[model samples]
Target: MEILGLACAAVLLFGAVLSIETRISRSDRQLARVERKLDLLLEHMGLQEHDPRLREVIELLRNGKKLYAIKRYRELTGAGLKEAKEAVERLG
Candidate 1:
């Protein structure tokens, strides 16, 4: 009976830990979404300079160097090539 009680307690503890971990993961995803939204809002408002690459990208785009802009954006932000391209395109 004592061993059974110990096993039950262990199971409960394991379940609780798993539940906590799951909640933490969900919260992290939600936080990331919120942060992304905030960044977009700031960018749209021109109220914050979140990334130094933005100016360079804009300049490159204005200079008709779209490829270079994408490359520079990727270098500065470490974003994927496609993402950098999309971001640069969005700037215009």
Candidate 2:
């Protein structure tokens, strides 16, 4: 019947979608692992990536305005407040 056929089609479509999503989830996990390894490698090499705009944050930090430094870092990097504050602390 047409109803049965439509049900089968819907089930196939849903299975396809689930398969694609599972593949994507697996890929994401793999990418995260690779990135973590790369971060560790970079840390072991004692090399840090430099951003020119970090200078502005450093200046604000040196001026004793910690909150302003965090705000500037967040603005420059589009980072969250906690991340920006941690970065400012590391830089100082």
- Provide TM-scores for the models: 0.52, 0.59
lDDT of 2 by residue, 1-92 (tens): 99999999999999999999999999967876785577578779996657898988889889999999999898888866766776688688
lDDT (C-alpha, whole model) for all candidates: 0.82, 0.83
Top model number, TM-score: 2
Model 1, which residues run further than 4 Å from truth? 49-92
Estimate the Cα RMSD of every predicted model relative to the unseen true structure.
Answer: 6.0, 4.8
The regions of model 2 sitting more than 4 angstroms off are: 51-92
Cα lDDT tens digits, model 1, 11-80, are 9999999999999999967876786688699879887554654888889999999999999898888876
